[model samples]
Target: MSTDTEALARSATKFAVPESLWNDDVAADLSPPELLLYRSNLLGSDLTVTNFGGGNTSAKLEGVDPLTGETVDVLWVKGSGGDIGSMKIEGFATLYQSRLLELEKHYSGPDDDDKMVGYLPHCTYNLNTRAASIDTPLHSLLPFAHIDHVHPDAIIALAASSEGEAATQEIWNGKIGWLPWKRPGFTLGVMIRDYVKQNPDVQGVMLAGHGIICWADTAKDCYEHTIQLIADAASYLNEKLGDAPAFGGEIVAPNPERRAIAAALMPKLRALMTGDRPKLAHYSDDAETLEFVGSADFERLARLGTSCPDHFLRTKIAPLTLDPERLNDQAYLQSSLEDYRAGYAGYYQRCAGPNDPAMRDANPVVVLVPGVGRITFAANKATARIAGEFYGNAINVMRGAEAIGAYVALDEQEAFNIEYWALEEAKLQRMPKPKPLVGKIAVVTGGAGGIGAATAARLMREGACVMLLDRDEAALDAAAAGFQSEFGKDVIRTAICDVTDEAAVAAAFKSCAVEFGGCDIFVANAGIASSAPFEETTSAMWKKNFDVLAEGYFLTARSAFTLMKQQGEGSMVFIGSKNGVAAANGAAAYASAKAAANHLARCLALEGAAHGIRVNTVNPDAVIKGSRIWDGDWRKERASAHGIDTGKELEEHYRLRSMLKRDVLPADVAEAVYFFASDMSAKSTGNMLNVDAGNAQAFTR
Candidate 1:
């Protein structure tokens, strides 16, 4: 900011500073190096400024070598594999400028460029090693004390165009160096050095098909200059393009409708993307996505390449664009995705060196459907969401380039080198192995609380995309929120479903299918408990228990069977009751209903065996503490009917009946459910697992 408060207020720069930060005396007290970290965070927090760890920042500081005991001017540059947006003091890897320049001689030009990235850790300011940004040399060669290099969308629009040179001079009112596209290495670093030598008065340099670099002695000056450069480019583009059209032609359906479409298409899409195997699908149709898909040049612009190289690694170079008319054509959709996969393999082959690892999976990260917007696929919800965010900003960047001039992207070879770079590939190898159920989809009925909620959480912990269904709208919502809070968003989908209603059951399954493709594991857990002697049972009371406990299981299992039959594989677990086996007195309605449900599971198992679907049952006894079925006076009712005095005594009666004599918590039932839901019981079906602390009565032969 200028020293004059009046001029600062009236500055009219398109890149305006937050008014609250303008006169902060505290910021003034921060050292120049500390301000570099501060300003990098501020610039990075905005996706338009830097997309997904795509930028670097630096500051020059004097440091005494601990071992050599000599005062050396060190260039503290943002390290490799760190995000500038959330970087801290340690994020800047300190390098001795004198030692760094020594490696510039062995360059032998671009062929040996890989050495530039490999040699950085050995050129540190002290004994501790850190992988510095390959661009560290450029920062040390520049005379400025503070420097920032970012892939801002506005500037990249100009930098990536054929007209980058003329536009840079026209917009900034100062000549900017323009180097032809060169992969980050010794050659590019040297080119930057020679540009400074020639253009002694220039404030910055722009790399064609790459991005821009700016510097000044102060953090405020450098950051302000970076912002102004971006602002000016944006102004030039806006003036040339006039007003941009708001993204349109989207359906903007209600949640259920959108979810239904998602469920219907997701299965076909997942099958196409991964063949017979399973994967996670994340759907969206936000305004930016709507506009991008609806645009006339959507296909041409999308094929141009990632908005930047970093985006390519996360989003792939180009998304798979599918026509909504082909939604029902499973063969065609799968064929289209397969063709995209093959094309990516061909691209990798054209640029691969012998040292490069086999081309990574052929699946495209982003898939676009007109009117439906976009869907990102990943092993888990978290990575899919990350790619979704990157691709979202990418549409804006590509559009800006169209408005500015022609949007040019890195060539296939340029992007291939970065994608296959050993350093880059190593990052993925370092990630921990995924959970066993990482890509599996699970649906848990009655998921609001009790055993259902515990099973939902456990499935998510093992990395499944879980859908929660219940009759209580408020409880279902609260349960969904808790899962999302614990697992991060998009991992859980909730539906207000009364399992007794076939239409609602079908819709809930349809929504789950759309949200996460289709179900791999189904838990028919929704039930109601109403007990009375067979002779005393009223028609109303008998009908209610049977309707919820038996009919609900039948409806859910049918949906699960249909989905599995179509896909040729699935798992189902019916939550049964011990009363069904022991036939407790005065529990005729509850026991009989549960008995029918258990038998229903066995019948379904016989038919599903042909389609590779496994079905089992979990008989849980006297889960009295957390059972909502015993919420009101039902606990007392059950106790009195059984000749027991209190709820505590009633629970103890069932506990003592078990061989292990332990309290059977809801989580205990969830564990038995997980065994069948996962591959652990791959060959087991038509079986009943007693989760009542070893109740012999409920045990199956």
Candidate 2:
């Protein structure tokens, strides 16, 4: 592999799909459905074989019908909207083979093919609720016992080439048949079934502008054959490719400062793209992405769009490419966005029928910036990341097709038809409704602490992506790892940031912008505590308290406010203490510093109001359990102030001191923080909410 970007583009290496990973020992004890799942995972694991959620696999098995005590053939296929790689047995839809064959009798012809889908439910086997994919007939109508339908980039390249049919015959020596382009449906499935009957020796058939389908008499053979077919296609393409440069050779080198540039550009792009709803962003500047975007043929190829239905469904018809030389030109960027929207709307108007689903948001999902990289936006982090992966697959397809012959995209009419298909529309409608904070991004200072971690978790549960910032690197890693396991890696990121350092605070916010587009909620919860009489307070104690609570709040808020102003709307929550308002008897240094922090929120709220940014404070008192602050000297100091033991006695003292006589936990403060961070407090700003168990002196004036 070459290290130079241009040299890497010019170097053509052999593309070898991994060999079949099946083991006889593993398959010996497995049931028919379990074997099918094992086979599906092996194929779907490699992107060269199939992109995420882009393929279907099935096995025909004998089972006793639940309603009737008779043996019947059941078609267990990958269900709708399921990813073959990670899916379990439950992800497969079970339908009676005889009933699926009977569905063909009611099918009038090609025009009435869609009506066939409506009858699929009547064929349910074992009363399985999993919805059958539209590709069900492609498996059931075939004569083979097992089938694999996958959109491998290698095979799709030949399928999408202008000379695809002739190349398919030359490469496979007539063993793999070819068919012209047709939208996937019952009609296409019937065509495939008839073609295989005519060519009895064929191993598989490549569908033009789509993918390949191969089958065998048993599960293992079918899985191996699928891998072999892809490997062969890749082998042929590599020989034909020679040392030819991909994508017409790189036009420019990858920029070293691209990440910084992307960070600067994302917030603006996010603001532009979020007309309907907010979108989280994923950025990729990998070797492949940088090579394609910097190539001379980038614009021409990107404009032609992705050929596979699975590709376009996730990435949209075409990506919006920005001029590398004018990337910093704001007017040019805005104009380009407007032009792309206009083109999309025009395409919709030209191809849509009366019954088609109303046009979706016209914003582009994938954005290609030359010399920088690819940035994809979606309703959440996972979808955004997957969109980028799918586009990368499309790039590979384009490279292979162009190497063999001229690359071709799906026709605009056909693309639009599939894009607005009624079944696809129904699938969209079936998706769960968006959560309250679906596309929102949050940053929490002191994120390794109890209250900070609790606040981050609460925000994530409501659908927000979060960046955890703490000065303690080990603690930050542990906290981030826990959240990543629970919420997924894409939604959580960590930064070793001391909020008191102005430069680190700014850089952390910049990283948040680059990682998740921008911040919408900023939780300034980082703090320190000190307890001393007014006369006994040391200079270092007062300054240290002021530095973290007062100065740290000021720095993080300033950075967050800048980002929110760019985003046009945001929320900021400051975690203060009840002592800030009530004034503690022995904790003069901590109490006075908190008072300054509370006043800072009011000032920021006034400043941010006109820009649609809301600032509020959550004042918590005596939250000892699970609190890192209370784990150290602060606990002993507060205990001494109250003349109580430094253990359970201190907790009981605080509980009884409150009017309600209840213990305050980190979760309680977190809820109050969430209220201010969410739209529930949308109209309320410049206000302080006390989370203490009701102290008379702590009552707001």
Candidate 3:
């Protein structure tokens, strides 16, 4: 190695991208398409290499034509909106190489390049339904059999540096070439093809203000080259980096109580962001994030905006930075958010063409606070988390670029064009309509129980992110795991919380705020059943019932109310027992406790009405199936009271005793809870719904 290379190797330790993970054994038996997917996954596994859905990979391979039964060259590229890390083979769009090449005849110039996307459908090789990405032409027009186009933070740092071309020439000498920025489309693809033709000896080219495109004859060679290039850039940046602190040193020290501050601020921030529609949030206060937010150049660098298209697409043109000292000042925070929205509106108005899509919600997706860190809001938890990740990548790019030279951002007009492109608008339109509760956050007490789990499922089905709270850790994990598997891990979180403990209750709700921004629905479904004749009832039994049924309800509801009030709207659903109204013969303690809980809901509803908080109840009778309360002593006691057998006979006796002769289930109660939880009962509050198989005695008077 040269003296400079040896010195770089000695000095560079920070920000190293992991070596290539490709294994010969893993790739040996895979087909060409599968190998392409494997290559994409290996490169995309690390955020330092590429972000979620931010890069594309393509393979030119021989495929049998269905009609002709002859082998033909085909191009398989990452489909539109597909994440390379997690995408399957089916996520790749297939097109005929010859047809893609023929598209050159239709392209008039850069002005008509966007029209080229319309012609891609005619090039589909096997009638593949996966939509081809705009980057398709960039890959197809290249001569290599395998290509990887990725936005690695390390390489992007060089691309985004003001001295990027000089640095590229310095680092690689003539092995790598450089091209000026051009939005990814037919025109840019032609530019890349021409550049490669002129510099056939060069392995790749860094696209200024964007990323890098590298290719090789084999997928393994391409993967290795990509990793080596990124590693070299990271080392070069690290070596060039002096002893100075990043972002011009820290302007504010990270507060140890930053999470507490974030929890308090999130609901208010969410309230402001929800003017157009509800939004879920993700908070990050990691060391790296804190460093960036607390840095002196935070505002300046953020104002310059992210250089990569993927970064700004998720994070927006820029983030809104708040004064850390004014975080607790509600009016100040509100004014700051309003000012941000106004700026965003002005940005849209200035850049929008006559044919551009109408301006979207002006609320900022990312918020930066000096001491606290970064918070991102989006339509759901995953998107919010991904946005935070993308911004994190942008931060790294900025750090590296500043180390090498002055960081630069894409031009304002170019950024606007990409942000509001007609094709991008069409992609947005193609997304499935969001569910009714798309941005709502919910918390279910006794979340491991049948009723709680069912209610959580119901709310989640409508697009609400749920936090499951239960005292039983094992059951909570099992329940959360099931939901995570079905609904994805992003939408579900678990907390070990006993509802009766005020501290635990408060902590659980705080956790909900930190995990999902704020709670919009609180399902008070935690309960325990007790039975005793009036003469046999003890003070201990009565106190136990009240402590759980009535007091537990109070603590959780109070916490929920506090959070919801900050957000300006919420719904609370209390799961009461049918006996609370009908008065069971041998269950005085359970019955009276539940009655108190029911009455409490009415009082809260009356008080919360002016604040847009809706409180309601769903009373379920003899929910024998899938009910934890029905599994033990309560079942035996109720059966003995009716002189029936302990198992199926008791269930049948209650079913027959009901006016409708139907057995109630947890799912039945959940449906009632759902109605109250959603906007379906928006106009009806301070009310109760009976899921009791029509027992007139339990009906609300």
Candidate 4:
């Protein structure tokens, strides 16, 4: 019969790899230079090739240094903090290949990582600047101009199985070498160099429970070969397992209220994780997640282990799963998570050495929600999204392995060593210290405009995840996008919520729970303004004004109260007005509503104090810019009332009239709101803080 190589030689295969994209003829087509970074980008862009920070690539080239005016043989390898898909020239740290190769003699064992980490930087072409990757020596020792390494889902499926070596040999035969699972460092690099030297005919090496490495003379050939290698494994799985198990029957449309259920559980989960102290941003909702979570063996399978051991840096050894049907059962979810944390502690105790770093918090980075998919928690928005992307890709890898064989991962002791390794832990030192409000979640009602939007942006700057709620869809989308662009994607979310409606207010808070584990600071800032003398003010006019300003604040505050009480502590802020304090004629309805809202805030503060909650109001006047409350007619009347023309004069008038001689910007109001939300004003509450540029008339008693 045909050999494995002969079968792969045939064009007919289920797994497909992209055609090589290298373009050598520059004059024929004008484009960015197709060099190492270009090729790296090609590999990095496809999640099929690697997950976040999962792969490394290198190119050896003869180059002239503009700085030194000398000919140099440089190995440009991917540096930390650079994603392959978006790799740039700077992303590729150029190291003297000859200098790197000499390190093979220096490495005594994996324990040498700490010393190697210090040593590798010294040998870099630019010693004062860029540091080379730990795998630099392995890349330099290989006898190839271009090298590609990846943790592709399909490839990992085969790499992380009991029959990985046998299955791989069946497919590639003598064309590939196999390496046992050796922890990544100097020793593993030496083993790879020796193996490749012995079997020069092999195109690649499959490292069991690790990943795959492919090397060649050209970038295109190396990249294509790596893709082809992964594809071969995928094709093998397809032939044996007939692809992943399909979901049974039409998945009846998911419970439309799963999000609501998740909301109720967020505080419960947070209390279980942090004891009702800090808030964390959470993201749950991806279609493919349910298939994995709902599988017959999920409860047992998820606990078995991770398909990729290195993922322990983020996801720990395994994920904690909960019954999807119990999404709303707060008591059950909380108890389950408590058990998960206890189990993790026990595992740490079993594997931890005397020198290991202190155990990390028992809280999980990824929570598997059966019907809902996954809920990823991070200190901030960007990290949560990146982690979600990584774990989301993991589902596919494990599914692929399961389709072929029982998935295998590193043992507890091994994973613990990698996770707590001083070298690995040192890699995280480069990240800056977190801001004061890091891990706190803030929800702002009417956040699509004015003071609300300003507060959202400010909270993000201080390292809090924000959820913006508004009645206007367009404004909500635009505002949410702006904050997301500035802060980072998935950090800020938007929900259309009309605060005057009790049900809408309830659902809006629930969305906040799903977006983030729960709320730390809830801002009731929805408001509107109108002007009319009491003689002309109809009952309808008073009702409309009260419905939004007074009633809306009550509804929003009431909703936040319930959730905060569940979590045991939270902050509530009301955006009031100077109009409420200094009563103005011809705007009696607006003034009365504002006055009533301020009173409502004080009452909540009184009640909130008993529950460990703090309530405050930021009362600002003429913070008119970006305010939805100020319509054209209202602005015109305000200017006419003050005998000023144009919007600029109106601003200047308010500025000069204030004791501080400056108009109150929306940001000024936000600052006061932030003070109450943060511990800065930890002891002060049940009162209003004036942000009207020092308006003595509006000062509280």
Clashes of each: 4, 0, 0, 0
Q: State residue 194's C-alpha deviation in candidate 1, in Å.
A: 3.0
Candidate 3 lDDT by residue in tens digits, 326-394? 887889988998899899989998898899999987889999998798999999999999999999888
Which candidate order results from sorting by TM-score in descending order?
2, 3, 4, 1
Q: Report the C-alpha displacement of residue 464, candidate 2, in angstroms.
A: 0.7
Model 3 misplaced stretches (Cα beyond 4 Å) = 1-13
What is the C-alpha local distance difference test score of each model?
0.78, 0.91, 0.90, 0.76
lDDT of 4 by residue, 1-701 (tens): 23422332221223333445555673245322246777787787787777777788998888666688888887888886567887767777778877787776777776776677676775677552656776666687787888887887778778887777888889998698899887776677778889988888988899888788889887667777887787788778767655334222113233455676667766777766753236474665654465556555566667876757546566767887877667667778778878888998998899888887787777777888665567776666567667777676666666656665677877778887787777666767667888877878888988987899999988889888888889999989999778777877767888898888889988888888877778888998987788776888889989988999999999988888988887777899999899889877578998999999999989998898888889998889888777776656778767766677847888888888888897678888899999999989889888888887777677777
lDDT of 1 by residue, 527-554 (tens): 7877666798899988888898899988
Winning model by TM-score: 2
Quality of model 1 by C-alpha lDDT? 0.78
lDDT for predicted candidate 2 compared with the true structure: 0.91
* Worst ten in a row by lDDT for model 4: 4-13
Model 2, 454: alpha-carbon shift in Å? 1.0
Q: Alpha carbon lDDT of residue 567, candidate 3?
A: 80
Best by lDDT: 2
TM-score of each: 0.87, 0.98, 0.97, 0.91
- Residue-level error in angstroms, candidate 2, position 429: 1.6
